[model samples]
Target: MHVKFLIIGAGPTGLGAAWRLAGHGENDFLVLERHAHVGGLAASFTDRAGFTWDVGGHVVFSHYGLFDRLLDELLGEAVLRHQRESWIRVAGTFVPYPFQNNIRRLPPELAWECVEGLLAAGRDAAAGVHPDAPAHFRAWIDRVFGPGIARLFMVPYNFKVWAHPAEAMSHRWIGERVSVVDAGRVIKNIIFGADDVAWGPNNTFSFPLRGGTGEIFRRLAARFADRIRLGAAVVSIDPAAKTVCTASGETITYGRLLSTGPLDRLVADQLVGAPPALIEAAGRLKHNGAFIHGLGFDGAPPDSRCWMYFPESDCPFYRVTNFHNYSPFNTPDPDGMRPRLRALMTETSFSGYKPEDPATLLDRTVAGLAATTLTAPDDAGRLVSTWEMAVDYAYPIPCLERDAALGLIQPALEAMGIFSRGRFGGWKYEVGNMDHSLMQGVEWADRMVAGSRETVYTL
Candidate 1:
């Protein structure tokens, strides 16, 4: 079989590309997804007990006008708007999101320690004590937040989320993703006892009223259902011949290939006759796996916060979302008129540097939730359903070697008429949001159809 454009993986990127191609009246494109279902990591599932859970915590907020319009067109009135009420759990209390901005909620001594550290950081900056740019994320944390906030929140919380040591990762990936706080702002908030919760781009987001976050992508994929082939995993790609072979023994020759799979796997395992340098570069690309737990309880949600970040070891998971709050239908309540269940979605990241025993993760997660005051000890008995999924290629680590690896691998593949984009494909955590991932594919389609320059996934 042959096609003008062949897209691997029916995730957000591939779906976006296919949608754009069809929108532009181009029909000679095909999408091959290894999974039977679409939406990739953004997919949602309804447990037998009737709780809907996303692969992890995902919120619908856009950085592009195209994505905004697309969401409006897809979800319409079926979407719900939410003001982000996120917090950090530390010192036996809840500080508002952007913990640095609202250190006033902490115990007096801890808050003062954070304040002192910020003052010291400010003085150092004024004196030009360390003028050189930070070499890694660790130094960047210390330089920007000072030792107090770094020790109390930034350092530990980051490690929990990334599953990699800060020193091994690059600070360049932190654009709007991280909120940098100053001594003055922190001190002022502490003095006035004010909350500074609206800092990031996702301050206010949208969600599907019925289905979870996956509904957006699921609806988008239906438009070009005939062009998608599920359970057709690619086994090999011969770049010289522009051919792709699936595990089902079908060889497809394509004019141009768009791969949304992990860039490392594409170069190291799938691509035929790759050079030593490219293979070595692929080996350097780092990523962490995620263990998501969708715990359903026989009561209303325990908190009003949308999600809470856990920095201390009291919890095995880095973050927990009040899943039921996102949508009433997320719980098993048949009528949706009166809610009776609480859905807690927790995400724990693991990597070579930080390994977790999945066998006992559920018990630990339940105990941790109670310990952290997310649920009462007796609430474990109230747990009616437990849904868990482990994603091997979860967050693409922005390591010191990432850009260098991408620099070599991306160009080499592009030279062979293969383009890799999306989260793992581009390996850029900064632009790995849902909107960014979809736009990367849309931009790729634009480039293919109109000779437009691709901006989101550029080297």
Candidate 2:
């Protein structure tokens, strides 16, 4: 079949492009999703017992006005807006988020170190002395938050998440991600006790009323049902001929292509006529794998906080979401009041199967939870319901070779009028959030449809 636009991958990025293209009403498009469903990592699943789990954890926070508008239009005003309450796992205590800002909550010595570092940073700044060159992620952290905070929170916490040392990563990608407190303000706050809750874009955000993030994409696909083809995996793309071959052996032709597949896989394996440099660059793109362990409980909520960060090495996951806190729909009935049973007490569960005894997994998760200080001992063994989830592509690692690699790859595709884009697509962790990814798709579509340049690409 021939169409004006052929979109590969039905994830949020692909869905967003399809949504915008259909809304534009000026093009005939077809969306081919490798998965049977539309929502990619943000997809949800319902158990026979009625528990729901989102892929890893997804929260909707927009960096663009257009993304915000699209979500509001699609999900509507009934969506729940939540004030984010997140924490960091530190020295066996749950410190408030942006942990560098809350050093006072840490032990006396660590707090003092953080305060002293702030003071030193102030003196250094006053003398107009800054690092002439920040060559690594560690240096970047030090420059932005000072040595004490970096050592205490940023470095260790980030280490847990990325599973790679800070010194090995690049500093150029950390511009707006890490908060750089004014030296005087940080010290003054330490002395007089000021809280830095209003520090990031995710301080406040929205969640769906009926489901987790998957609901948003499911609805987006619903609106453009005729153009969407789920369970139809695009196995190959011959860009020179503008054709896509699917897993089921169906062939499709298109006038223009918008792909949201992984940068490496798309050009290297899937695209039939990829250029040499694009394949090489795709090979250079590196990402971290994540095994998301979701534990569903049968009792009261664990904490009011939305999610918690882990800097410690004990827990396997760098972050854990109180998925229930996203909405009532995320868990079973709150009023039903089932007793929570604890299952496994270890960080890693080797018993691959879902434990018949729900308490076993819950126990293990709670033990790890307590070990991580994410939960209390009193709350460990009572979970009656339990579940664990895993995702192979939860994180895109910013390896030392990422930029140099993508730099070699992206331009070659661009030269062919193909824009490599999305979380795994553009392969830029600096700009790979849901909003950023979706906007990348929309902006790419705008560029393709109206001869406009993409701002996300420029950024």
Tell me the deviation in Å of residue 81 in model 2.
Answer: 1.3
CA lDDT, every prediction? 0.92, 0.72
Residue 404 in candidate 2 has what lDDT? Answer: 85
Clashing pairs in 1: none
- Backbone clashes per model, in order? 0, 21
lDDT of 1 by residue, 1-459 (tens): 999999999999999999999989999999999998999999999989889999999999998999999999998899899999999999899889999999999999999999998899889989999889999999989888888899989999999999999999999999898999889999899889899999999999999998898888889999999999999999999999999999999999999899999999999899999999999999999999999999998865546789999999998999999998898888878465654778999999999888999999999999999999999878888888999999998999999999999889888889999999998888898888999999999999999999999988877
Could you give candidate 2's per-residue lDDT for residues 1-459 as a string of tens digits?
899888888887888888777767845988888777888877877655566777676788988998888788888875888899988878767778778777767888888888778777778767878748767888777766778887767887776666667777887777668777766665566788776777898889899887678888888888888888888977888878878899999999888887787777888888887767667767766665555555655454446778777766665556788777777676667344555322221122122121123344444455667687655666545455555654545566777788888777777766655667788888778788889888888887787778887888552
Q: Give the Å shift of residue 437 in candidate 2.
A: 1.6
TM-score of each model, paired residue for residue: 0.99, 0.89
Cand. 2 Cα-lDDT: 0.72
